[model samples]
Target: MTAFIENDVHAVAPEVAISFFKGIMPFDTLDEETLRSLARHCRIDFFPKGTRLLTADVTELTHLYFIQRGGVKAFLEDENGEVTLKDFRGEGAYIGALAIIRGTPANLNIETVEDTFCFLLPRDIFLGLIEKQASFAHFYLKSFSEKIVTTAYNELRHHKVTRRSNEDLYLFSIRVGDLVKTLRKVAASATIQEAAALMSEHRVGCLLIHDAVDAEKIVGIITDRDLRGKVVAAGLDFQQPVQTIMSTPVQTVLSQSLCFDVLLKMMDTGIHHLAVERAGKIIGVITSHDIMLLQGHSPYYLFKEIRGQQQISGLYPLANKIPDVIRGLIGEGAKAGNITQMIAILNDHILERMLTLLEQELGAPPVPYCWLLLGSEGRREQTFKTDQDNAIIYSDPEDETQAQAAAAYFKAFAAKAIDHLVNCGYPLCPGEVMAVNPLWCQPLSSWKRYFERWVSEPDPQELRYATIFFDFRAGFGEAALAESLRTHLNQHIKGRDLFLFHLARQSMETRAPLSFFKNFIVERDGEHKNRLDIKKQGLTPFVNFARVLALKFGVNETNTLARLKALRDGDWIQAELWSSASEAYELQMQQRLVHQLRQIEAETIPDNYIDPADLSDLERRMLKDAFTVIERLYGVLDQMYPVT
Candidate 1:
């Protein structure tokens, strides 16, 4: 390996090295003085194809190499000699930073894929820059999760008018612990009057109730509203134990949790207070007010308004506020996953209120039923534009007359509920896959039969149904029915390898839209010419692939991100592969969301189509990287289940 390498003194030409470094990131942020210093210390080396630059366990990495020309392949080899490809680094890509920074031997076997030229910064020079330059060091020191999100966010901030300044944006970065200034606790045996008096004296709106037997053990929570509603409004005795009106079990968040996540949790659960804990000990309390005080706009308020509204007419306009809330969250640098979860929670609130109003007007349900949120909604991945993909699963009927009654009541209930949702801006499902569709709205027994048949008699058409229906989650009603149905579905598919093969084959049908030259394979001529269907080409492959693997492993998570995490946790997928796939999914989601927001601003219907030409150079490059990751992910599926 040393014999094939040659040094070139000309590689450190200050002007050329500075220019090249300026084009690549982190280095691009550096001052001319630092770049010159780096150039002066750097040496360029040439290696022939098949040259081993660094081998795991065999070589110690001494320098960080910035690829100037050609490429290298990084992989791992097990004791059995089975190899796993890690990544391919080309021009503008760098290597050995992770190893050099961590002061460890190379974890990957790095070899030149072709005759390659690289500018090498010695260990001393690398460490010097890491210590002296904050920005350059941050790029490498940040965790992969933070790096991908911040990279996309910084790009967004550069392109858009993000209303919040850097300082204001920092509010979202504050942890739950940082916001906890007080921890008020009351014994469960305390009278309601005494608890309210303590709250008043302390100027607190809520108190964490601890067990009389174990004062440190938080048992329940009682808020100002609970005093007014559960005590005064209900005409309960003021001397009654606080436990009479207190709610259990107390909601708690880790001290390390972001205030942004805390706000989302409050909104999702319709709660106002959360206990903050550090190292398993309750330390303080953080409320919605504490988080809301940091920002002018909050979805928590909007979520509250939706929950308070009783009439469908009033709820109609609240749905329109979702886009503005999403925009505010994006401006505040909320992550793609958090934003999607917020959207799902807001949508669920609106639907829940809508159904409640229906039950009031049309009378209570005739039988216990579960309202199923299917497809993207079920996965909690809704964006700006989504139509209804819902279903209903009712309990088994007791008799023919009861069955007739349930059928009539739900038929009318689903149609009216869907109409109200439509008035609130939800479009109808294009495939008629909503609660109002008879095929989708059925008894629990029928749903079980549907899954059993689909699993045993796997076909392309049934696989399509499996792709959508398999992601069902109970949005409302008896959730037990949904859980029972899931158990039944998993049971039937437990030993069914052929079903998994068919599902994998279905996933393979949609390939990444990249070509041989690494350019986008977009339509040449049409209304959508030069535009890529971001959903079908970019997002579907991930959704499909995650679903396929989740099914094969009997992982019950419905969300793509959650499924990927479960797979990684169960050791079903490699950690590196999970990281790549997760980052790719998130980056693509950010692109699609920004695109949809732009369309909404233009007063046009939001869509999944994105024109690569319209994207900034940074976004386009990241998107291409995401696409490359997707293609590699499919390779794993291919090796598992070869589609002939």
Candidate 2:
């Protein structure tokens, strides 16, 4: 195997190459000597087109290759010489490593489609190096565990989809303990009447003929309809092989396929049953009945219900059913994130209806305006008991008088809508930050002035406005109005280092809810005495960190999670940091959901505060971990943007 020098490999976009190395095995935690040794063993080799590096039938492997450039395709060929493409590997991926490590023949044939350059290391040398280097061994084990975890997660998600589709199709796999019909061996020349008698004796809807050693590889299936229409109706001889009338070329799916995908296939083809295949062998059959029964209530009906609501009052009933809808989605095994997104969509529709009704009650606005959603609503991460945190932005007025008139008109309209939303189940914003607040319903110039004042001369009181108002997402109105405001803010905040520093410092002000000993830090005294303020302690920190990064990076995205992802993708923050922040956000949101569910159960209004006594030990630990992530992120931000 050819080896390449580490310096040569590092020469290509060195920083990114180093990052990729640090993220993977061996190099991730290698000592200087181990790193040097590995680098010495690593040789970069080039393969021309049509080169076969590994074949399925190859019983031994001496080296593992890591692709540095170009692409390779791994495929399997059947007896008929038809090749099935399994996977494609390119840069930053290991090729033929699994077979080399597992000491098995390659499950797939790897061939270069074009000229490819890769780092090669002899299997024995790499194994010996890993054994001698503790850090290398640790990194390898961790990498393997992570891969297994990721693969398991993907499989679980796939299975969930399959299980849900099974319910929708009203299909069920026969259990070993259940009484099932058993058929004796039958030759291809077996009489049709004899097979019919056996099927009748078994009292089954269909007959499975066993011609091969593997009973599951059913050569033919005879349903009652087939017997009646093909045999009895035609007055055919009873002493004929069942295969003569059996359906040929049966369709099949791998057990690994998602259920919903299978359901879609069945629906498209107008077929009920699909044979389950693994490694080109049939195991069992999944029927349409199985899929239908497994599928829970469809969300399409809910969408239709929302669309059919004519007035604001009509939305009240649907809004009330929102919790049930979420519960149904959860029951159907929808991912928490996906369920939240769907709920947000439904909430948007309800809010839209309220806006429509408000517009009818109070005539159209005097000036072009846009209704803005703030906080979680703006982020589309709202739960069942979200509050109204919105504002209105109209075009700059021709004069002060016209601006006042436009602001007043929007304020009144917002107030009406807020009231409708309250009646529909959403509580009014506690901070009075809604559009109904006279300070919020303003012209474009006034909004810009508000933002400029907040940015140019930052104050503790105004910082609150900056945090919430900065996250404004267009809920309703002229799209251009919001865009113009966004453009203005983006332009003003780009080089304003002081503003960013202030934002970062302000973000760190919210002390994480854990004490020195890592115990819960309850509220000192208030209406929520002895309670943990989840919003103030958990959610706000992540929100602040994301906001600071967004401002510094001139990222136009408003949603906190989106901002975090954008920053990570833009290379502003490391992936691990982004992942930690995201996990913290998700954990906090889940806690908030639990709190909301409890409130709904008790028929009480949900709030951000939660009593520590109510939390389980596991939840308390997760909460602490979430806070720690935020605390670390705050430290990073502090270092990046030091206080003046």
Candidate 3:
């Protein structure tokens, strides 16, 4: 490669510095103040071909390079004085992250592939930024450096690849207003032909429809499909008002809302486009096309497909495709929790759609009701498609006759839902903790009474059942009902010494299979002999720990990691312990998921029984470390809420 400048000729005008970093990774999310600081420290450097920018044997690292316009290649040196090309980095690529994070010498040699213009950050500033900015840390955490390079190389080597935009990949913190830059608008009085013309001119699929009387108020939206269907299919007048073809109440997301939640709402509503409202006024529009990550077979698409199904037959195909989605996410190096969380959300969509189908078949219900999820589903952590652990809480009727009628109505509803779910591959919950069971299906008043009874006067059996239900979330209908129930339970049960004591006692039933000495205590004499049930042994202990911790500290988050973060943020637990628990939980979940995926690949039923021997030296070490963290947390639990 050739360059116009030498090492000494490295600098850029201050005016264009911020704009230059606006679309780059790790820099796009930084604020103006931070960006200025970066600009102050940053310098522009040009390197020629065969230039040794960094060497594998260097004792120290000095700069972090961001490729501006050309490419850089990384090489690994062998025992001989020769080096092999390990990976290549193109535009927007980052180097020196591994060295900076490790606080050690550079591990690979980096050279310009061509005349490369690079934006360079001093090693100290780069380290400081990642340490202070959680977003920067998380981006690196979510990506594997070498793997990223490999993916880029493969895509470069093969066919043309469509890449995610800077906003989609790195602008998780930046708002919709920042995302879209401009809001497209149309008057409600505009004709269909006029709206189509406007859309065509703008090269957009949809426009936010404004109110006729109040121009500032966004009342509805019209899409290209709206014109094609609501206009042409129905043979409507071309001069007719656009409001007739638009979708109303306008599913609006706050302009300040993060892109993740924005995508989630789009997924949940199956609305491909949404209007962004800032301070109660429409400002911009965002679409599924904008967020390129939501592609084929993604959770969002699956949920949208689920919502479209009018019956169970169509749902089978969507539900069956879930495993493939999970596999795809795993292949993409998505976080284990994220894959499970997406699965949980998709499963809820299936149930919600099924409930909608049932309600339609049986007609509207007699009262307000909430369909609650229990166990892993409630906690938002699920792997394999599993049985239903759900219950219903309906509003109490006035008299005994009305109660009987209400019971009759819900009983029929529950039976159909359970059977439908079973046909869709979600088995009827084995423990009879299903909505079809009268005991689990009860009036809202009855639910309150039951929770009070369970906590105030606990039994071993009731405690076991209570633990399963405590992680409650609404899958469908009246989500507020679920939230109200949680608030009530927390108000009464949190910090009640006697209740927490019993709950802790019940939670301690499962023990971690590994010891601090790094020895595995495998089950010796069963169908799964010499195999450890990692879910029961490794995960259950952490679950119990989180449940008790959340209850004790009044943290309302149901997920284990969420509870730990809440506790740490609230100063209820030390940072060291919280970090340990969080890491340990992730490690266990990741290992369990890999094990299940292995089973699926082998064409065998996926399960929790894992042999320590199957794990590598690093995995074995991680498993031990995770177990040790749990054991320490257990010791803390034993001290705080001693059962004996």
Candidate 4:
């Protein structure tokens, strides 16, 4: 129905405006005096259903409309006049904040979905509030994203499980610099006795060895373990140069790196101590002891146990305990990203150990190669229910004899690796995408040809392969091979606009599990009756959307969050849209993890289906909101290349 604002109306009372503002956020954060000032300037208007309150054609937004009653639909309209719905916002939601704050036309349309009563704050008042109120300004800028993330984990805050010593906060929020106490260094020419004396004097666990010529340049490092195992135990002369005993190539992390990531690095590299660097210079050192002190029951112990295990049978029990550790982290309020990264770290350790054992049994390969992880594993976003999605990429062989030998060795290696991983609880990829498939285990040249064919000759089958293989990352072995393959893949897809268009269209094939009225559209019948495939329907859209844009723009990041961040920083996408997509992805991931965790706790095999009936009211709202964010992202893609 065509609509208009009521021409006849009484002026909105200040008390009424103040009352409404106090009930919502940002405004509720304001002081009473500031609220009164806003109330004094506010005016009310009633618009009939289908009223075009704002649109892309407007030169500038005149007022910020706060929905006092009823709701509105915001959407984008492309040059072809095809509309893509962005969201259904109800009471407490505001419109024109983006346009007014930027002094630009509305980037999308906001129209009344029902008979809507709105409290209108003029552009001048809104700008004045923004300039004078820091909290109010931050809300429009980024606080909404915080609310989105924090609200999603509200259930975690109230979980009845036994609480640990705030380990989640320490792991995710504390930086490496926070734990590093001091930097202790010695010249490479210093005697082992002098290094030991320095360690004793400072009461330190390790000492960084600097270059003999350049005092500022660190050349190596020696820890207490090295002093005991290499010097004391081996009966080396105490007067020998420390360089003879020092372990070359010290591990270092930036001062700002998270404790969680530091722990992962320590566990993965089997290092007890790491130098902490700021800019390019080492400032201090952090030990695994320091991290473990923050969380005495952390995964460091489990990782140590995994590293010490000699056989695959020993890893099975350890692998099963991982879900419990992750659940405990979640119960303590760790974010989805941190949880997944921790899972990936542990999984990587198991894979590394399994490969090492297998190599010992089968002998070394004929050529240098990398075990490439694809899809979620590649992105380091593994959850409890992950399967093997891997491939093998080896160097080009010297000759036919060499080629045959290389193929036979890796063929056996892949089969053993896959079997060992399955024994350790990682299921086989249903599609045979794992390295065990001879089709996927290939030399560098073959892998390059595969990517070129997939990107250049776009088709349903080819794009399917593109979607999976494009997210490859080297999990183990020679990383250079994987890096070279990534370079080749990115170069091939560059400037391939048609391929991107087809990819984007294919990405949208699995529609969000949302309906026209913003209700969840679940399965009609079968085992998943009344449930939705959260992984395929809720999660994959975000992954695919980011992949298409990242591919088009040559973003080399494999992780969804990182790709979205690159897109946002480059202004390839709107900052607000980036926040929405990121928060949405995290929330859905949290849902998926909690669901899988419950299944594991019940001793049942975990899957992706989520019943709307199982979610709390807030969770349901968050899920619906996430689905809306996915559609908005799709709208952006549609604007780029309309899927006709």
On TM-score, the leading prediction is 1
Name the regions of candidate 2 deviating beyond 4 angstroms.
Answer: 1-298, 331-336, 398-408, 524-530, 611-617
lDDT string for model 2 (516-621, tens) is 9998899889798999888778788888888888877888887777899999999999887887678668667766765675577678877889887866443565
Tell me the deviation in Å of residue 264 in model 1: 2.1
lDDT of 1: 0.85
Q: CA lDDT of each candidate? A: 0.85, 0.69, 0.77, 0.85
C-alpha lDDT of candidate 3 relative to the true structure: 0.77
lDDT of 1 by residue, 1-644 (tens): 54434454345688888888999988889888888988887788888889888887666777888899999988766456765335688998888887787788875788899999898888988888889888767678554445435555666644653464433544467898887876789999999989999999999999999998999999999999998898889999999999989899988999999888888778777778888999999998899888777765577778778989978899989999998888877877776787898899999999888888888898877789999999999999999859889999999999999999999999999999998889999999999999899998899999999998999888888988998899999898899999999999888898899999988977888888999889998978988999999899999999998999998888999999999999999999998788888988988888888888878989999988888888755477678888988878789899989967
* lDDT (Cα, tens digit) per residue for candidate 4, span 474-527: 999999999899889789888888889999988878898899999999999999
Error of 4 at 472 (Å): 1.3
Instruction: Compute each candidate's TM-score over C-alphas.
Output: 0.78, 0.58, 0.69, 0.75
What are the root-mean-square deviations of the candidates from the true structure over C-alphas?
12.3, 18.4, 8.7, 11.6
* Off by more than 4 A, model 4: 1-138, 160-170, 173-190, 198-203, 208-221, 233-236, 240-258, 268-270, 276-284
What is the C-alpha lDDT profile of model 3 across 363-397, one tens digit per residue?
Answer: 88887889999988888888876668899988778
Model 2 CA RMSD to the hidden true structure, in angstroms: 18.4
- Candidate 2, residue 562: the lDDT equals 85
What's model 4's lDDT at 570? 89
